[model samples]
Target: MELAVFLLRLLVGILAFPVYLLHFLGFWSNICKKLFPPSMVVFSAIYNHQTSSKKREHFTNLQKFAGPSGKLSLLELGCGTGANFKFYPPGCRVTCVDPNPNFEKFLIKSVAESRHLQFERFVVAPGEDMHQVADGSVDVVVTTTVLCSVKDQEQVIKEVRRVLRPGGAFCFWEHVIAKPSTWTYFWQQVFHPLWFLLFGGCNLTRESWKTIEQAGFSQLQLQHVQTSPILGLVRPHIIGYAVK
Candidate 1:
């Protein structure tokens, strides 16, 4: 069994050599920036279809957080293709941040289609270093399925806290590692390297919920959910809000 597992992993590494070469030559990032958006659209469609009900359940209460101006300033990190735009409260102003500029066109198209949201602007920056966004400026900070791909989860959480106003909310729904005893966990551990290469740095086994909980949010309401088996290794998710 051990030898079989080792041979399977070796085969995966051999098949992933082209992508590894691209990374070694510093071309993988550019290629991913160009290709990932369109691929993400197809993935998003399937993923959103499976998770929409839970998303609606989590997002419907955002209106209660609106201030006296009756408008919530929302900043979304890693807002790829603006998939969550339709779930936001009507008339809420939304600023988007993403590292890949190639996603801007698709994101703009999504914004145009989402008439309920007021499109603020899109900043090309990673979640870890959103220096363009001001401190304590937004009523809410949101992230969905983003932390697993980020270079620094701790810094990104720190930045999330920095941008949120007093009493503001941080909403998140992210896939996490499966239980240690599961077959899914075994596969996730085995294929993580090849998966990371193919998916542009997304890890299969990040326990991102722990980072969110340790970020010192004044109040947190989080729940672990198991989604469709179609998601395979990434079927377990953590979803909820935390007040800063």
Candidate 2:
């Protein structure tokens, strides 16, 4: 019975790892919106759940800050599957970019199926290397849980600033390394190598907030909201807006 149980677990791992790796490598970026529909649903549910009291308070505050209106031209970098489609106002035009060509397939399908919002265009190229996108063309650029994986983090932030028009907002929610926690640091140092290898280039120990600041974000407002209840391995979140 023990051997049978072990075999079952191994089989599940074998099947799951390849799928996980494909998504991580952005190899499946095109089909990702459809391939991970269930995960998209789950993430949407979580975001929607934040509509309650405490979460709603935070949401309302962010909404005011976001200035959601018809005139805003938004750009989402590494917009995996367009999970935040519901966040934008209906008439606000959005442009989505992902480095991997795979995003074209999945994002196109997801965008077509969704009723309310529509993207102005979906491009396949690294947003950080924004030669393809015209300069000062964007009103706002957003990234979520994506900065940790980029190979050239600084370059990307500079690109975000470049693409955004004057007075444009760049918003993000990213997980970064925590300070004064030696134990968590040690674990992150150890696990990050393997994690990066298997799950794309995501390192948990990056100082993403500082990176954003250094990338010429002149008007910056930051929020370090805690994600985990436990002491160690807390995903100290960086959420806020930076303006060019």
Candidate 3:
């Protein structure tokens, strides 16, 4: 009887594996979107620490072509919970824009922790339309892991270009679609429908960098890298700068 029960429990677990994968993949990036407002803090903490090292390097690259840290005006599109706060250079003024209003509390906490940066106003709007920010006024625009999930990649890139100063730079780090040959790539394509449904429209197959390149940026210094993030669909990433 005990052996029979053990086998039955195992069978149930096996049956539910696909559903579990659909909901919990990509370090729970999509799962948190479905979480209750206040409870998102726990998930935010897990995500912040989980990808810290690699993201830190990505953040560091933002300052490379930034020219001068002091007196610089930086804009970050999709600044989710201010995850990149600590990495920003001191003395720079920042403007954060995101559609999720629930992140205000989380951003407040992170802003307090990131003393080096000057806390500019948080704009509640989508990246695709940042009309509140005037044209050619920003020194730098930064984003990390944002492009994969936006409604319109082309519009967002156009907005990024429109707001930057003549010599300003746009820095980004985002996951891209993988090649068709790999096992993870197969799963990324196969389970995409379920993935998007569970993750709030976050698509794993978008060619985000391609859209940016064609956005008429004068120069693009981008590089692609494969990361091991437990979920293959969100592992292959691109990080670099596009100068206007």
Please report the candidate that would top TM-score against the real structure: 1
lDDT of 2 by residue, 1-244 (tens): 4454456545655666875677678775455534444454555456445432433333233323334353667788988777666666555678888875545665777787666665788877775686888888887888876898788898898898888778788878777887644555555554554455444455778888888877776788888876544423435678888888
**TM-scores of the models, in the given order?**
0.95, 0.72, 0.80
Better of 2 and 3 by TM-score: 3
* Weakest 10 consecutive residues of candidate 2 by summed lDDT: 54-63
Model 3 accuracy (lDDT, Cα) = 0.77
Whole-model lDDT values for every prediction: 0.89, 0.67, 0.77
**TM-score of predicted model 3?**
0.80
2 or 3: which has the higher lDDT? Answer: 3
Query: Which has the greatest lDDT?
Result: 1
> What is the C-alpha lDDT profile of model 1 across 119-176, one tens digit per residue?
9999999998999999999999999989999999999999999999888999998988
Off by over 4 Å in 3: 1-50, 64-69
Worst 10 residues of 1 by lDDT: 1-10
* 75 Cα displacement, candidate 2 (Å): 0.3
Residue 144: error of model 1 in Å?
Answer: 0.6
